[model samples]
Target chain A: MTLVKVYVTYKESILDPQGEAIETAIHGMGHNDINGVRMGKYFEINFTDDAKDIDTEIDTICDKLLANPNMETYRYEIVNAEGAK
Target chain B: MTLVKVYVTYKESILDPQGEAIETAIHGMGHNDINGVRMGKYFEINFTDDAKDIDTEIDTICDKLLANPNMETYRYEIVNAEGAK
Candidate 1:
């Protein structure tokens, strides 16, 4: 089995309202040291042992369901489950 | 400057409806190879150069706004922005 971590974030061109809201809250909290924030989605996928051609499989999944290519970009990292034991 | 990546995920005890939805969708697409999934929120917090005691700052922020500790658990890593340049 493998554990894949996928992170999807909006492109630089898009306006991230949530990120802006957090930035405003930070300023209100008097934490002016934080100039910006960007919010995103993270997924922890448990891929069963039988899954094959893993890289291609994940790519298709990301393209089809995990990310909206028009606005967001995604990247993922896979880890061997056995190594954690 | 520093970049802090905060990952907040549902505690193992809680039911993750969003994750379950994705898992069901995966199965519907004929990818029965995945048995489980957990969804999480990812944040990219950009700390200005003047920020101080970053660890404590982030800790407070996470406890107060970034997560509902009763339902979610969070972990973060601080990285030197300069190092990535």
Candidate 2:
């Protein structure tokens, strides 16, 4: 099995209320110098096969379904995959 | 400045259509054994100050703003933060 970790985040132009709230809270907690905050998501996946065309497979996944492409940006890295190279 | 990386993801029980689509695409791309996919987000923040009360500040950020506390889960690690200990 191979493990993939994917991270998704809001586009810079998008207003992130959650991030804004966090920034405000942090500043209120005596960290007045904190200027901004942004929030995003993470995913950990396990693949049972280590096929040769892994990158292509992942790319298809990303383009076809994993990301909205308009609202968010995604990046993934291989963490580990036992027996899948 | 100190850097913080935060990740947010859906709870396991939550349905992730994006993840499902990625999984299907991967399986179709000659990796039939691929079973599941989950999607999430990532954030990188630069703090301008190295205040002593960093953890508490961050906790407030998380509890009050960074995470929904209902629909998603969050975790963060410090990657780098010059002059912030």
Candidate 3:
């Protein structure tokens, strides 16, 4: 089996209110050095033995569902469990 | 400034309905090789110059808000924008 980790984040043009809220809370907690914060979604996917061309499969998965191309950007890394060196 | 990327995911014991829905959709799209999927929260934090002991700060931040101790697990990596190579 292989595990693919995908990170999806708001596009640079999108405003992130949740992140702003977090930043405010951090400041109130005395973390005065913090400049800003942004938030997004993450996913961990496991591929069984039947999967082939994992990269292409993930690209399709991201484009089709994992991320909204209009408002978000995504990147992924695959961890081959069998090759856990 | 430096950027810290944080990923907070549901603990193995937690059931992820959102991920299950995605997996079902993927299967509908014909990618039956996918076994399981899990969802999580992602954050990008920027640290201004006054910040020190980033690891400790992040540990506090994650423990304080980024994650739910009872249900989520978090990990982070620091990216030094100034040292980009």
Candidate 4:
């Protein structure tokens, strides 16, 4: 089986309010050395050994479903299923 | 500066309805080779060089805010901030 690890995050130009809120909360908790924080989505996808055109499939999936083209960007890594947790 | 990448996910015994729904959608889109999918949270945090006991602080933050200890688990990696995007 193949395992794909995908991360989707807001574009650099976008303002991440949620991340800002978390950063404030963290600061309130006394971690003042933190400079910034960004939050994103993570996904683990497992494919059967018979799956074909896996690379193309992953890109299609990310563009069409996993990320918003206007505000977010995504990247992924493919690895043997056995190597992932 | 320091960069910390954090990944938080549901515990093995937890039911991930969102992931299952996405998997169904993917299959409906003709990606029948997919076996399963799991969804999680990702974070990128930047800290100044003066941050003290970062490992301990990260543990505290994850336990108190980033994850629900009963249902989720988290892991992180630290690297030079300049190396991250």
Q: Best candidate per lDDT, number? A: 4
DockQ, 0 to 1 scale, candidate 4: 0.93
Instruction: Tell how far residue B8 is off in model 1, in angstroms.
Output: 0.6
Per-residue CA lDDT of candidate 3, range A1-85, in tens?
7888899988889988999999999998899888889999998888987777999999999998989999999999898877321
Candidate 2 local lDDT, A17-52, one digit each (tens)? 877876776677666757567777676767666455
Q: What order do you get sorting by lDDT, best first?
A: 4, 3, 1, 2
- Evaluated against the true structure, the overall lDDT of model 1 is 0.87
Candidate 3 true-interface contact recovery: 0.95
**TM-scores of chain A across candidates:** 0.91, 0.77, 0.89, 0.94
DockQ of each: 0.86, 0.51, 0.85, 0.93
* Model 4 stretches astray by more than 4 angstroms: none
Best by DockQ: 4
- Model 3 misplacement above 4 A: A83-85, B83-85
lDDT against the true structure, each candidate:
0.87, 0.69, 0.89, 0.93
lDDT of 1 by residue, B1-60 (tens): 789999999999899999999999878877878878889999999898888789999998
Model 2 DockQ reads 0.51
Work out how many backbone clashes candidate 4 has.
Answer: 0
Stretches of candidate 2 exceeding 4 Å from the true structure: A10-18, A21-31, A68-72, A82-85, B10-31, B68-72, B82-85
Candidate 4: residue A53 lDDT (0-100): 90
What tens-digit string does per-residue lDDT give for candidate 4 at A1-85?
8899999999999999989999999999989999899999999999898988989999999999999999999999999868654
